[model samples]
Structure formats: C-alpha cells, structure tokens
Target: MKKNYVVMDGNTAAAYSAYAFTEVAAIYPITPSSPMAEKVDEWSAKGKKNLFGSTVDVIQMQSEAGAAGTCHGSLQAGALTTTFTSSQGLMLMIPAMYAMGGQFLPSVMHIASRVVTSNHHSIFGDHTDFMTCRMTGYAMLMSSCPQEAMDLAAVAHLSAISGRYAFMHCFDGFRTSHEMQRIEALDYEDLRGLVDQEALQAFRRQSLNPEHPTNRGNNVNPDIYFQCKEGANVKANSLPDTVQHYMDEINKLTGRDYKLFNYYGAPDAEEVIVVMCSASETVKETVDYLNAQGRKVGMVQIHLYRPFSVSHFAAAIPATCKRIAVLDRNKETGSVGEPVYLDVVTALNQAGRGDIRVVGGRYGLSSKDTTPGQIVAVYDNLEKDEPKNNFTIGINDDVTFTSLDYKEIELPHPGQISCKLWGLGGDGTVGANKNAISTIGFVGGKYAQAYFSYDTMKSGGLTQSHLRFGDEPIRSTYLVSSADFVACHAPTYVSKYDLTEDLKEGGTFLLNCPWT
Candidate 1:
C-alpha cells in the first residue's frame, strides 16, 4: 500500500530521502541548504537506520573540500555515500568530483541550487552553483517539486550504483527547498528491489581484497593515457540511457511520467518556453492559462541538464514554435547568452530550424521573486511581435533597459479554492504554506499547487504565497491572477500597490495586522 506524509519544505523532504538510502553522509552547512544537513544530523542522532539495514555514519567536516574528500573515500570503500551542499560549497567539491568520475565512483550529491555570490553575498536559490559543476563529468538531473525530488533522488542513486557515475540531483533552493507540500512517501522495499544486486556484488568483489592480490590505481604513461581517457569517456556517454531506463521503470510503478526533456502543453503549439528546475512549474501554469484563452503556447521542462540531449530537446519542441523564450536563473557576464539559452538556440539551429526567433532572459537570481505577472509579460511580448534579444524580468530597467512593458491583467477565473498569504521574511508564512500543502497531499482527491514571490531589496520587501487545491492537477501557470482569497501580512503593502487587483468579487481577504 502507498503511504502519504507531509513535509514542511524541499530541504526537509530531501533530507528525509537522503537519510533513508544513504549509508554514509558527509556534509558542510551553507545557507538555504543548511537545513538539509541539519535534518540528516537530527535523524542520525535519533538512531534511525537507513534502507541498507545499517546506521548512517554522519561526517561533519571543516569545509566543503573536506566533505567531498570524505565522500570520495567512503564511495571507494564500496559504501553508498551521499552529500548535501550549495553555492561555494558546491564549487569546493568540483576537484574531487572530477576525480570521482574518473575513477567511476558511485555516489550522489543533493544540491539545493543557490547563487554564486558576486558584488555582494546572497544566500538564495539559483542555478549558478549547479551550472559550475556541469564540466566535472557528473550526471545532472533537476527536480521541479518535492514529489519529483523524492522519486528522482532514488533514480539518481540507482543509476549511479549501476552506471558507476556520480549524480548531482538539484532543485531550486528556498523556492522548492523551503516550500512545503504533501507527497506519497516512497516504499523502501521497492527501492531495494530496483538496485542491481549483481553489479553491487561485483563492486564489492572488486574492492581492495588481500585474497585477489590485484594492483589498482597504477600510474599510466603517455602511451596508454589517451586511450584510457577515451575509454572512460565512452563509458560516461552511455550513462544517460541507463539513467532513462530506471526512470521509465519508476514512472510505470508510480503512474508519473518522466524523461530527459519532458514536454507539457499542446503538442503543436506555436510558441514555447524552455526552462529547467522549479520555475518550470510556474511556466506550465502560465502556458495553461494562455492556452485556455485560445493562445497556442506550450513548455519544455529540461530535467537532464549535463548531458544536454540535443536530439531529445529538438524532438520535444514543436516545429511550429516560432517564438521561444529561454529563461535562465544564472547569468553569464560578458557572454553572448546564458548557458541554457545558448544550448537551446544551438540545438534548434543544428536541427535546421534556424527560422525560430530565440530570446534569452535572466530572472529570480538570489531568489528574487518570479510571479505569474512577470511570466504573462513574456507571453504578452510574444503576442506583440516585439521580442527583445536579452531581457530581464521582475525589475524596472531604467538604464540599459531590455524589459518588456507589462501591465497586470486579471485572470478570468479566480481558480478553485485559491488561497493567498502575506508574511514577513522570517515570520514563517512560507513555512506554513508548505505544511498546509503537505496536509493536502495526505488528503485524497486533491491536487495542490503553490507559488511564492519576494521583492529584490531584502528589508521591507514583500512576500506572498499563491496556493490552489482542486480535484484535477492545476495546469494554470503564471500566478493567481484571479485570487478568491487574499491574505495581507504587511497591511502597509495595501497602501503601496493594488493588492486586490486580482481579487474576485465576493472573495475573502484576510489581513494580519494590528487593530489600528
């Protein structure tokens, strides 16, 4: 029987799953992602045994480099090892990560995707950390939600052990990590059955054994060095198929579909948005809203980031998609375009679809708010046929401006049971919504969705939560344009902006304020 549970945030769910499967866990705490490590420590302290039927050995190191070293050592000893980190901590592990891949070590790293600080320090969600690891030969997979996070974490582990390649499983930090939801808890027995027993036995047998008396890690001369490197490359290239096979099996069992590049929306839509990570959810919602209004729009969510399956991406995107907006969280300073955007344009050109107009934009860096209003702006630009080459969203660009003029448009439907909340930065409004979503996940016959938006300037910046619960999976993207219920935590914001612009007639509005 399937079991269901509530989780407060993405970090907690990731920690729970890590503790369930990991035999050895090495960690170095960093903001946004620190809670993941903290949860694992708490579980270990309580003597919770993992699925391997052994107590998890937790290692806290001085720095990210030390944690990576510990992970490499543990994996070499034939133990299933895992680690959690973000930002500079992830960058610190790159050197060891390259070596681990070269040695074909089966290990997994859960990254709460965060921004790589520049100019000033920011401890928020972005893909800069994970993007830096792309060249290290690790297989990268991104999860859009907590449910996918749990399921794909298992898939990453199973594939790593079977394929002998390290796996980097990431989701947006704070956005997905700190956001709460209810998802069906995975069965450990089913996971155990998925492991390749014979391959695992072979790995144990190949460990340094006195009986076998084999010489390993021999330094090679130039004569065979190139040949050895090429052999390793060939083996690494074959891992994507291996990873996909396991994903298909998991989907069959769970009734959830997954692929290297998953397409959502009309198969023959004329316009599409290509994106990765948690933001894809918001895009999907927007696509649905536009499609319902008779606008032919669709989305392609990239799940596999590292391998960059060009053929798969081209196939998933419809040829009729003339206007493409590739939104990236990370920016490449002084470059022609952002990484993912560049890849998409290249894929389309290589596929002989150069007629498609591709525009790139940077949004939500350092966890800056990306709301449906901003997404609708992208579509509005497409409709006007005035697509900007390099655009930035969620900001007012007075100098060197490349932003499209966006007016707030009300959604036709207030949506089914739309719930909005206003809370202070640390007052736990975001945390409370996560708990509520987890509760809804436990209740049968309801599909729950949540979106959060925060201001760029930290102090006094607004934070709002848009949530919806209904009988069917909520496909409306963008944001709660027509909100039935609005909660205002900072009563002062109502004086600054039109908080009730999208509030439907006869809708409920809750304000958390003093009786003044």
Candidate 2:
C-alpha cells in the first residue's frame, strides 16, 4: 500500500474496478459515461482476465436499454454482468432495473450521473438522473472523486455478490468522470478478498439452468403476488448491513474508513452541512478553514444514499449541531426542496431530532461552479437568526433573489503547481495533460489531478484542460481559478477564450503556436 498511484479519470478508475469483478459487460456509448464502457471493451479485446480467470465478454449493444437487457439476461444466466451509462441512457435502463431488482440479481452498473434533459439538453454534471432512480431498488453508492469512484466501485461490485442486489455506483457526470487524479489503486488480489466465494457459488446456483429445470419470470395472480413479493423483504431489508460489511472489509485493505455516512469537522461542531459527491470534498476544505479559525462547523457526507438509514445519518451529526444545511446538486423546482434536503428533513423527523433545524440548498446544476466562498456563505447563514432556507450558489439570481452574496474565495493554493491549457477539441491537450500528470504523479511521488471541459460540438468545440501537481492530496474540487501557469494549446483559442484569465500576477503564459 506504499504507492500504487494511477493517473486516470473517475470513469477509467470505475471501469478498471468493475473489470476485475465483471464476467460480462453490456456496453453502449454516451457522453461522459462512454469512456467507462469503451475501456471495458478495450480490456476485453486485449484478453484481460477478471477474477474468474477469463477475459470478460464485452458486448456492444444497440442502445442503453438494450445494454441493460443484455446485462439482465447475462445475470440471469449466471454471468456476473455490468454496464456504464448516464442521463437519458440511465432513464432507458429503468424498465430492466425493475426486473433485475425483483430477481435480486447481482449486477453492477457504473454511472456518471448527468442532468436530466428538461428544456435544456446540456451534457453537464448533475444528480437529476440519479435522483430518479431512488425507487429502482439499486444499491446507490456515490464516489466523491476519481479515487473514491474506484474504491467504491469495488464496493459496489462486491456488494452485488454479497447483497444480491443491483448497484448504481455513481459519480458526477463529466466532473469526476473525466477528471484525472493520482490515486492508490485497489490491487485485484486485495479486492479478491472482498469477493465472497460462498456467495458467488450461491449466486451461480440461483441462475437459470436447463439442468436444474426451475421456473422464473412467472406471472403470479393478485391473490398470491403480494405474499410472494413480500418474501423478498428479508434480503431487501438486510442489504444496507450487507453493504456496510463489505465496506468494513475494504477498510481493512485500504485503511481508509468508509461508512454509510462520514463526518468531517470539529468533534463539537455546531454548524453542520449535509451533502455528497464532489462538493462534499470542497466543503471539507471550507470546514477545515472554519475549524482552524475556532468556528464550529462540520459536514456529513452521505455515501450510501439509498436505503435512507435515518439512524445512521443522524448519528454522524454532532449533538452540538443546531443548524443544518443540506446542499443538493440537482434541483427540484416545484418541490419544497432538493432531494437530499427533503430526505434529511424526513430523516431528522424519523431520528426524532426535529429540534435540529435542517434546510436544503441547491448548487452545481449543469456543472455550475461550487467554490469555497459560496460554501462559506452557507456556513455564514447558519449562524444567522434566520438562514435562507432554500438557496442557490455560484449565481447571482437578482430577479428571483435566491442566491447568497459571499466574498470571492479561492482554495488556499498550497504547494500545488496549477496550470490551465486552452485548446480546440481537435487538439491533443487533454491527452497531453493526462500523460503529464501520470508521469509527474507516478514518477516524482507527487499527487496530481486533471479536469477538462468543452462545448457540445464534439470535434470542433472549445476545450480547456486544468492540471494540478502537488506533494499532498488535491482537494480543490472546483476548476483552476488562479493557475500558476497558463498555456494556449491551440492558436485559435487565443482569440476565443481568456487563456490567461486567472494566471497569477507573475505567472508564465506559453502559447503553443508556431508564431509564438
């Protein structure tokens, strides 16, 4: 465990983790999530062997639903199956999810959750697509970054076999999915321990076989249907505990504590913020800052968002907490609050801590920036006599006036050397940075992270790559606001975007143009 750093995006990390557990992969390409499926396909083509000592059978399907159906069929036939998808693609998998849930098939689906298409057809990051799958009976586990995406992805697949339930191990679409980072990878051999040999054998026995001659997918009458369905409650109810058991096993291997809910802050924190995914990492920096200044602020990160354990969530909060702000990534426009916020309200009521005030706020809709400053505003509001209950950040909503006014804040740039590269889509900027970070992170024993953003015009769009290198873990979840260096990877970009926008006062600007 000294160093097994892999410089890759969350999508690649998740895909790599799933590759170790999967026997068959039903694949289809969609933005943000496509790289995950593509990686599986490439590995299988290269004759990569899984834990079962065989190359995974990766089949490209016609659509997301077709992929889901193929996974369902494969799982029913005793093949450990998985798939990667997002946004509309995820919606297409819903019908199959219902069936997979009923049979309690151990299938794992890796998702880079995206904004559900409303009036806008944006290909940005959000939890809207995932929020829709709450009732799908899949064990929903979220990864806060590329590292967690890999770590928790293993947890998802292991839980698939342990709990006999489908999994949607999700990360922010295009945010974590495409963001590359330095992370210690889970050795497949170490991961092999989380695999329950007994469970796998039992799962195989349950598979449909002509030799055994068992009936499945039979239509039961209303008289007997309810009783038959209720029978599954035993396993369904035990799933959360089953998931935590695997988490405990992983903790032993990785030495990183993961739980249903994780808390970070002063032990006696009073102002609490509840949230998950990439923003939770950003909030932790803010929490660290506030705590350093002798302020009592904390954050409770929800990892196992499904099963909605009221007791577990409430236990993570400090007893001194009086005001709680639930920051949700996706919005519920017509509803009283965002999904996590409302869920927190319900959980508090169920935990019988109604005296503790909990409010929900929305941030990072369509990958909108969630900075340390905006989070500071939430903590600032928590101390007020009356905090703005339903709020939005990273925007000035002067018309409706739901936004909070906070100082422009950038993360405390430690020893990290940050850089930005502006390029056209056709340029090799992203690929170059990927290699650069890997070389630096893997060779220099330094931690590095990279993130890319581009327009919808696939090949000809504007592209920006953000790169950071440091001796410590990279915790700035947001993009490079003030880089120490800026480079224009394409000359055309020089006339388009502000390539030197946030370069430090004495920062270097290198234009990758012939004339320069």
Candidate 3:
C-alpha cells in the first residue's frame, strides 16, 4: 500500500488509525476528545469499510461510563472495540476498565489526556487524568504529537490484540488532540499486515460463546483471589517486550525506529531532559539548537509508560548524562514526586545510576504555556550544584518560590510561517484554519500544524487558533506566542482578548468588522 499524507489533528489521526482495524466503537463526546468519536461515528454512518471488509459499528452511549461498559461487552463478545475520552469522562470509565483488564479482554481506549478538574474543571491538556489510571493494568502508550498519536495508536491496537493487557493511548489534550499537523500515514494494508492473525484468531476462540459459556467477574473469596490476581503478573511483565516487538516491526515497515524510550541529542550529553507528550517535541528542538552550540545535552522521550522497562530506560540514557531533569506535566502533590519523576527515580535506582542526579519539576497543568525557554531552564537546573528539589516553569510561583528563571529564547524553525486567528465558537474559525492547513500541507508540500483553544461554555466565547507550516517537520507544541499573521474574526473580542499581543514586527493583522 502506498503512503499518503494529510493535515489533521491528533483526534482525527487516532480515529483514522483505529477506524481501519476496529469492529466496534463505544463513544461519548468530551472536549478535545469528542472529535475522535465523532469521526468514527461519521465514517460508520457513511458505511466506511474497515480492513475486514465491513463497516465499523459505532454505538453512541449516554455517558462515558456507558461507553466503557459497552466497550467491555463488545470485547467480551469477540470484537475489537475502542473508545475516546478525557478528564472526568475517563474517570467514569475506571470501573469498567478494571473489569475489562481483570477479564483480560483486549480493547483500546484512545485518550486525549487532560487535567481532571484540578484548580478548575479545565477542558485542557495535561497528564493528570492519564496519571490516575497507571495502576489499571492497561498498557499506557504515550505519543508526543499527532504523528505518534497515529503511529503508536496502531501499536496500541496491535499490542492489545496480541497481549493480554488492554491499552490507553494518550497525548496532550488540546495541544495535540486539537492541533493539526501534516504527517505521512501508515497504509491500512501495511498496518493490517502487522496484526498477528494467529493471536487474533485465538482471541476470538477464547471469547464468550454460548456453545461453551463461562462465568467471569465472579465473586471470589480470599482463598484463591490473591493467587488469581498475582497470576496475571507473568503476562503483565511481558508487555514491555510485546510493545517493543510491534514497534520494531513498524520501524521495519516505515524505516522509522520507535522504542519504549527514544533518545535525541548529542552523543555525549552531560545534561538531559526526560519527558513525554507534545513537550518532548519542544525539548527536541531545544536539544538540537543547544547541541549545535557545543552543549552536551539531550532528551529521553518515554513512549511506553505502564510496564516501563527500567533496563530499556537506562539503556536509552547517554552514559555521559550526569544531570537529568524529569519534567512532569501533572503534579502529584503529597508524593515523593510527580508520576513520571517517581517512575524515572525508580528506574534509575533499579539500573544503579546513583552517580546521575535526577530532579523533578512540574509544568503545563491545564494547558499552561511550556515553551522552549522553560525547557532550557530545566537543563540549567541540571547544571546547578543543588538544583531546586522540585521546581515549576512557565509561571511565577512566588508563594512556593520554586519557579525557575529562564531567558525567553526565539525558536529557530526554518522556513516557518506562524499565524493566529481569533473567533467565537461555531464561527467556522477552527474549520477555516483546518482547511488552510490542509491546503498548505497537502498541496503546497509544506509541513503544517494548527491548534485551537476555547472554553466549552460562555456566550460569544473567544477561540484562539495557532497555525504554523514550513518546509521541515514543525515541532513546537505550545501555542504560538508570536506569529507573522494575526486575524480577528469577532469584532467584539477585540476588547475581551488581546488579538495582536504576539504579532511579530511587520506582521499582518486582519480584523473582521463592519465598516462603520
């Protein structure tokens, strides 16, 4: 099958990848994640045939919990089932997720992972929601951006079908989920060829059949309950290899190497940042810039998190990495450190890396800005003799006094053209930006990216659109702080939001208004 490229957001990418293989999708609409389910529903409505030569059965549930319950039922009845959710919607699915995992039902839950109503019920990007589901026995796969969101999402489905553990494939909520990017897609035939036919057939044979019915989710006493629960450890421990095997197979097909942890930087980097999600892309750009300047710095991007292999993580780190900063997108207060930080500490401890100093910091809660400058601050902290035990970035934390000082540095993206659009919800601003990106990316042969942000409720709510395209693959994940073009489609928003706050010198500003 020939490869094709399209300009699309993370949600659309996930939908397309899953739609190719899925037999059933239990859907519930939630901000930043609704588009994924909507895409599946629309396609199913249009009678889109999956590789199985049948249109996927999309069932819209009353709630997220209903979606999860239905997903479990579908998987039990021998169907490849999935769902898309985030934040509170995800929390509602926990009980069913446990049942599905406990029963060893293979399913995939595509999450545009978001902050779960912390400071406020923010419908924004973060790992706080994903962090809470770490112990659910699901194979948690993290994708840094839309492309990986598409690639690893397929990996998740493949892994689930082959392995006993279900999968939760996640990325930054609005940053990646709503952000559009041009990417070379995996051909459906190529992806289909990678699925283990024997494993899938065996799974189908094991499904619930009236001809050979069996009782699951039964009440068990302490007698054999512990043994039955601990019995899954063998399969659970084997997930790392299972995930890596598919990643390797994908690399062979695509010529792109993907592993549990991918390292990018100078060969002998003394300082490094270990992170995941879209921020890894931003950090990679920082690493590339710093490496050219003779700085021995690098980054380790974590893709497989649940069954994190300490050996693989240790192997990925440069032997010369003396100081490392683990950036946590979600803050787990009252713990030793944030989720990933603790995991990194445990991994390093297991690998006997006592010589390397590892510190943790928090950033990007509820979609707060996490720029390259903030990442540079993380590296600077690594250079310190005694860096702040736990620091914050992209904010002034005067109360805790744990904020890192960083000089705002300009990102050097070649042939980059950034644009900003301001409009109200349902005003077609987001739609227009999507079309603009598609035109530039598919026709102009330029790499393109776009992201939209707006509150769910609010009359005449303001929506911010960030669009960028260039000759090279665009990596900056955060919103456009500075743009070459700015447009305001809603005249009333002029007094409410700063439209040209980040416009560059000689930048074009277009305002839509009545000629009074």
Candidate 4:
C-alpha cells in the first residue's frame, strides 16, 4: 500500500530515474542538462515501459562525444546503458570516460551540473562538469535534492550493475534540474530488488560472445602493459567496497542515510563545512541557524565523489574540528587545490589532523549567488584567529582582489523555512520548485531541502528557491538566511531587491503581482 507520486524537476528526477533500469539511452543535449535528454525523449516517444517490461532504447546522439560513443557501444552490447549530461556535456564525456573505465563498463551518467565555461560563458549551476570527471575513472555521485535525485539515481543504477563501475549521477542544474517536488515513487519492486541478480546474470554471462570468442580492444605492447594497468587499478580500488555494499542495501530499504560522506551539523561539532552539490541546501539552513544560536557548526554532505573516502572523510571530521572551509564550486587554474579543497587537505593530512586548519574557497561559480550572508562569511572566517590564506565567496572584491567582504550579518532562526522564485528565464520557477521538493518530500514527511540562485546573463535570468521542511535532518548551510516563506515571481523583484531582507520576524511573502 504505497502509492505516492509527484515530480517535475531535477530533470524529472533524471528522466524518472532513467526510465528505470534503462536498456539503452545515449542522448545528447546541454544547458541546464537539456531537460534530461528531453525527458528521456518524451519517455521514449510515449512508449514508456520498464520495471522489467522493457522498451527503452532512446538513442539520438551526435555530440556529447556522440553520447559517449553511444555509452560505449551500449555497454559492449549487453545493454543496461544510460546517459544524460551537463556542462560542456560533462566535458564531452572525457574520452568516453576513459573507455568506460578501461572496460569495466557498467554505465550511468546523469548529471545536471552546469557552469563549466570558465572566465565567461555560463548556463548556470556548477562543479565544473563534475570536477572534470575526477581523472575520468568515473564513480562520482553528488545529489542534494529531488529525493537525492531519485535515490541516488537508484544508487547509481544499482551500483552500476553489481559493481562493474561507471557512474556520475549528479544534481544541481537550475537548482535540482528545474525544481518540482512531492516524492516516494521509487519501488519498482524496490528498484528491482537492488540488483545483483546473480551479479547481473554473471554480467550477462560474460558478454561479447560469438559462441565464447574473447579478446577485446587490446594493444598492450609494453610487456604486460604495466601489469594490465595495475590490474585496472585493482578493479578500480575494489569499487569502494562494492559501493558500500549497495549503500548498505539502500540504507536497509530507505530509512534514509547514504554514506560515502554524509554528516550534517553538531555531533560534537567545532566548525566544519566541506561541501558538494546543490549548495548543500544552503549549508543546511546555516546549520540550523548556527545550532540555534549556541553555534558549534557542522556539515559534510559530499556523496561518493569518485571513491575519495579517506576513511570516510576522516571519520566525518569531528575531533573538535578546528576550522575548515573547502566549498569549491570549481576553479582550478594553477592547481595544488580545487578538487574539494584538495580532498580536504588530503583527508586532513592522512588523519594526523595536522592541527586542522584547512581553507580553500571559490563559490557558486557560474550560477553565482551563494547567500546566507555568504555562509555567515564562511562561519565568520572560521571565527578568525588569523583567517585569510585563500578565499572568495559571492564576489565584490573591491576592484581586482581576493574577495571576502559581504558582511551585514543577523541570521539565527533554526525553525526557519523559506521559498522565493521570480520566474522569467524559461519560467517554470525552476519547475515549480522541483514540484515543491517532491511535495515536501512526500506529503510533509520532511527533511526536504532546496537552494537555487541564478542570473549571470542567461537571458532575463533571476531565479531563487531556498526551501526547508523539517522534522530533523536539515542542517543549515547558506542562502535563505532567514526566510520562512518568500515567493516573488517577478513583481519587478519587489521594486528591485531587498525583498524583505531576511524575513523571519513574521515571515511569509509570496508575490507574483498583477494588481496594476
């Protein structure tokens, strides 16, 4: 007895989770993830059938490197392939993502992430095309909205068909792919019983067979080609414990708690921030309004970014965290930093915590606007004892500078909730706030979050949706400093800006004006 549904964004929950277990997708389109390959080509031109019923071969390529060479020849012809893109079409699928991770090929790409134009051209949202596909070995994850982008795109297509490896499953393009909400529609018999049906039938009984003839794309002529590329890097580092045992069996059938990096504020917090996509729901509402004013602050977010756990991010940074920032929406010009602040300073110097200081910044990127008073000015410059070393957030650097001053703070309201939208640039108000965050995460069961701010020249661009519906699991991050409800679909931006500063004192403002 479970029938709840509602979707409208995060590109229709990534084309309804790639029309569930897609047999072959391979699409190509850009901008805020080209309406998820135009809703999987209008649900494969209205045929729509999955849950093992089949009928999903939506092809249509000719770009994003010919949809990553038709998802590497439809996963070497055995099928179960997928695709969708963003930002320079995920940088033109980096050499077919290093030949689908040197032939481990288990495919999954979805990625609404945008903003990879550099110094100018932008389509919004950012992470520089999934941080330039972390060395192209694939396995990146990130998602902060649209029911964790349809339960992590069904846990990266059931852990890429039982851990063969190749996934990207991102989010945050036009704020969770055109915002819309109301969820609880994933249980195609519990995602076809979380894959591994005898290891996807022994990977289709070891494919590429013409009555069992082998030999695939080989050319290793360097005497055991570096021992077959270090045995394909020990099978891509044992696929992060086979993707954490299918993310602990889908967190024991959806009790919600996916790991590979997922901690949020206050559990013995001191001052943490590290981030990932969808602006970690505005830094979890500023870590529930600075832990309701007591202020210890905490946050981690980051979901499996190319197997970079480092002991699960140094055991979710606690040992009385002594100030860290990391942020990064992508910008790595002269290197030494950028990939999530050099993997949180190499996982806090390999956990020795080297007196934990860490600092690295650059924010919102092509999509700009990172508010909550610029995350309370990066937690007031980590309560400065001598802060500045490397920073920039939201902008205004006094004519050619490092940026850091946007201060005018006055935020603290844990039970805070806000919503604001001023449509125009393709007015769907980010697809009706991703359908109100899947109807407040399925009829207000709560723990729903959304944050969006656009307008860096994308034609009449000016959008904002920063929502929060509580009952635990919120953890404030940034933007919507105090809202509580504010919607204004362009009544000329309530006479140009200051749309009631940070509301709260009595909150609730919804304006789509017409009373001319």
Clashes found in each candidate (C-alpha, N, C closer than 3 A): 9, 0, 0, 31
lDDT score for residue 255 of model 3: 78
TM-score result, candidate 2? 0.97
lDDT tens readout by residue for model 2, 128-198: 99899888878799999998999899999998898888888989988899988888888988887678899
Q: Model 4: what TM-score?
A: 0.34
Stretches > 4 Å off in candidate 4: 1-8, 12-38, 46-55, 58-77, 83-103, 109-138, 141-165, 172-206, 213-230, 234-273, 280-304, 307-323, 326-374, 384-516
Mark the 10 consecutive residues where model 2 has the least summed lDDT: 492-501
* lDDT comparison, 2 vs 4, better candidate: 2
lDDT of 3 by residue, 275-357 (tens): 99999999999998888888899999999998888989999999988988999998887987898888898889999997889
Task: Spell out the clash pairs found in candidate 2.
Answer: none
Misplaced by over 4 Å in model 2 are: 228-230
Residue-level lDDT of model 4, residues 1-516, one tens digit each, is 265555445677767876778888888777777777777778778887876787788887778898889888778867888888888877878998888877778888888887777678877787787887787778888887777787788888888888888888888787677655445556677777677788777777777778887788877688897788777777767777777777777677766788878889898887888898778877877787778889988989888888786877888888998888888887888886787888888878987897988888888876666767788788888889987646888887777677788664555445535655556666788667766676777776665667566666545777666776665654343455566677778787777888867677787777777885
lDDT of 1 by residue, 1-516 (tens): 465555445777777767777888898898678888888888888888788787788899999999999998888777889999999999999999988877888878999999888887787788999988877888898988877788888888888888878889999987787665556667777777888888777777766656776776788999999998888767767877888888997897688899888999887887788888888887877777788888888889998877777777888988778888899999888999999999999988998889988888988888776766788888767666677878988888899896766666544443367877776666678767766765675554467767666655534567778787766655443357667788888767778878787687999887788877
TM-score of 3: 0.97
